[model samples]
Target: MVAAIASVASVAARRIRGGEGVATRGRVLLTLDPGALSHLARGRDVVLVTGTNGKTTTAHLLAAALGTLGPVAHNASGANMSDGAVAALATRRHAPRAVLEVDELHLARVADAVSPAVVVLLNLTRDQLDRGSEVAAVATSIRKSLRRHPRTLVVANRDDPVVVATVEGMPRVTWVAASAGWSGDASLCLRCGRQLVAKHEWSCPCGLSQPQADWELDGAAVRGAGVTTPLHLRLPGRFNLGNALAAMAAAHALGVPPGAAADAMADLESVAHRYATVRHGSHELHLLLAKNPAGWAETLPLLKDYPALLLVINAREADGRDTSWLWDVPFEQLPPRPTVASGDRAADVGLRLSYAAVGHQTVDDPLAGLELLPPGEVVAVANYTAFADLWRRLAVMSGR
Candidate 1:
């Protein structure tokens, strides 16, 4: 009965897309089975990317790269849940492969229904406290899923100890190392259960025998697909480069030819609002959804050499009830102070920024906070809910 309903929903959704060019059948199915993605795949090349951060970006890269080789199915919109997976999968006809990004904690549910050719665990970080297990616990869940699928090749970030530790000795898995040491930090050593120390801007090693990786991404600009543009991404920071490389390696592992995969990344489109740059009068606003500590840390480089205001919003229960991790951020790096504080929980965001020497001007609503921002160059770091509320205002203000 479950299969029948899902197939029917997907068929009707496909028909609607032909005329309307928009599919809602997948949205409708979300109510029936949030974990229904597992059922839709059989004898198709499947690439699954699971992690706390950068899954959306990596998935988009993989989708773009795979499109050149053959038809590909991808949840590029970042919905990422079962319904979203069905929607993406339903749009294609006779596609050879599908690249899907699964939420870290939900890997077990999704993996149960679908078999994958390669499973790429990007990196496990502390995120969504109310909903997920600790990094180690979540890594364990992913391990169980990997253990269940014996043939699936595991592609991963060797720099991340948690994921590297999970499938260390697992055979038929390819590990890829990325040159993201400059801006990102993976604190714990997955091998010895000790804090892996980093020396002279190199690897975070416990000096123990760890598994070797298969591919490596080195340098600021990437060289693949016969293109070497340096990839000075419109999106700021170095950690994102790691996300880009993970997709490149995964797509290659799934057999998308290296040259074409790089072309897809170079000709990539923004994932709706993920790291989308919008211009106001004089200031440029980069919109991103930071939901956890690692998510928030990924954007720290955004504050480099900017005297503009900083806004941090923390309200969702999934974001964690305690915002004490704000102190953990190296806010001392930001020299100047912010202009105002705003969000559903403006007080909390203000307090965090305030401790870092930013002033507090409360606007109970995120939309109202936009009014407080002077009509010049501005930077805003909003939570998912706050971004949803103020996205319209941001579009209008930045002339999106």
Candidate 2:
């Protein structure tokens, strides 16, 4: 009865608001019945995906891979909190399998309620410093959750020291040699409080270190369980290759064939709007979302080949009220190009670019900001809310 009411209210709310309303609907349902989530998720084969980055993409890939086996329920819109989990499960109670994207901070609570069959822990990095927990705090929470839920199969990134520390000694762990390029926040050991030394492998003087990965990514192929399958990912970057590996491991843990997982991942064109190209007015804009310093570092390299780019930074609640992390990004790595800065924090981004000796012009409006860049395939990198706003605007313009 509660699930039926929550589902109806959620759908009605979305109809009235004319937005996706995934989060809002879940929030409304949770407000009415606090136990709605646990009740709805009961007796389901739930797969919980959590991390600082790649949660949405990895969840999408895992869910898609699992879809080959049977009907699956997943948080497809990237609403990853407790309410979001409830919304996904409540709406699709008939589905036999559930794939949920869980926030790093809320993983413990969500895991307790969902009792996930498999948990995928992607790379951790400093994200939303003002609002989110410290990287160590998040790692501690995940560690506790893993210890509490001993039966849950953990599909974790062996390359990430924090993830390794979290699931260390836990039984039924499937480790993947996922590549994590950003290490600024992982300089210190979370367990021993010692400086970590990294070369081919990472280790602390106090004895805690990265575990040997069971599934290793060699070039484009993933090797594990006496089998090797070529990972032909449609998503760009080594980070995405890592996400694919994590998904493959999670799928394998859930009895999905390696070949079928890889094939499903290859068919994925984009997660939400991370790499979608849209035509706005006369400019063809390629949209990319980079919410923090580490994300920006990974995204900046893609812009190197482009002639001109649009960089948007908003200090909205979703994007973190603190825009200070912009200085930590290595904007100096960017070559000489006509960069147009946009968003509520456009001036702050322009100042950071100035310190790095990268020339840029600031425009308050994102749509108008495109005027600064020359036409023909302009790349626009936007932080959280800026990216959301632009994505909505682009979608409306494209009549999608």
Candidate 3:
């Protein structure tokens, strides 16, 4: 009854705000109360997408790819949980379908509420150990959620041993494997309890000869669909290609036209702080988001090649203050050590670099490093919390 009341109240609030009648208000109502999800899709379909690391980016891209079919609702601002899901449905009025990028920990909770017509599981990696169960625990939670609702279309990443191994007994799954350099195998076989060996180049079982998608991302271009459009991806690195593939494959699973997939990629966008470029008094800082070992490891090559000053911020627990992950991250790979470190945990950042024997300076905020940095080129790597802190400080410093 409480859920129903929230639905009704949300609709009424939308109407009071001059919303677009029941259609728009209805989406809002359904969000506040997920029984409305069933009601809204009574005769329609919904798509639910989830993953660690790239959920927001991949979810939005898939939604945009399928948007050509009709109006598509998604968490454009990356509010990808139950509350954010409620917030997303609250505002939108019309869409043929909703493509939601949901949180890994909250996937089951929100999935039960929204009960998406299709469920997408991207690669599961380590992140937010405080707010979430360990990756293995969260993967089990996802399996349990799927068991409750059997009709949802399942898209599973085959390259991730932990993610793929969870759903082995289940036959109703579309398998997706990325043949790129991201090859990760953190978990072993559920049935054999043995670490499966990769064949066909560290991809399949026990080095057995098998067929797999040979995915080589040329810039933003993906092979294997005879689909080669001009690569217009805003983000760099090979990891993004997998995110792009997840979007493309998930869009295909939704029955969206193939052309729309490429078109959406052509018109892609980015959320704030995911490689967002900021200009402060003739200085350009590409705010790159690096939160975990995988993400941090991926950044090393990019940072090494980038011809600019390195600025990093690691403040909150979310940034993994232990910073021991840096040991595995190969910090010495970058040619020059970071020039400045700032945040509540700036010392932690400096210590990690120092341990790796990377050089650095300490500052109170991003712009403080600016006083010592040359104004021509610079890069700022901020974790989840530090990003916001740095953003506000930069905003004030820039008078924006």
Clashes of 3: 3
Q: How far is 131's C-alpha from truth in model 3 (Å)? A: 4.0
> What ordering of candidates by TM-score runs from best to worst?
2, 1, 3
* Candidates arranged by lDDT, highest first: 2, 1, 3
Q: Candidate 2: worst 10 consecutive residues by lDDT?
A: 11-20
Cα distance off (Å), candidate 1, residue 72: 1.9
lDDT of 1 by residue, 1-400 (tens): 4566667776767655221222367766656766555555766888888887788888887888788887898876665666566666665635779988887776876677778888888887776555647777887888888889888888877766677777766777776675433233356665567666556332344564334656555476554434453443434557667777777778877776666667678766466475666775555665666666676676777656554553646567545666665666665566565466676667776677677775557777654555566666566777665665466666766665
Question: Higher-lDDT candidate among 2 and 3?
Answer: 2
State in Å the error of residue 186, model 2: 1.7
The TM-score that candidate 3 achieves is 0.81
TM-scores of all predicted structures: 0.82, 0.96, 0.81
* C-alpha lDDT (0 to 100) for residue 154 of candidate 3: 77
Model 1 per-residue lDDT at 381 = 72
In candidate 3, what are the lDDT values of residues 45-112, reduced to their tens digit? 56778867767677777777887778876666665656556545544535667877777777887777
RMSD vs true structure, all candidates:
4.6, 1.5, 5.1
Which candidate number maximizes TM-score?
2
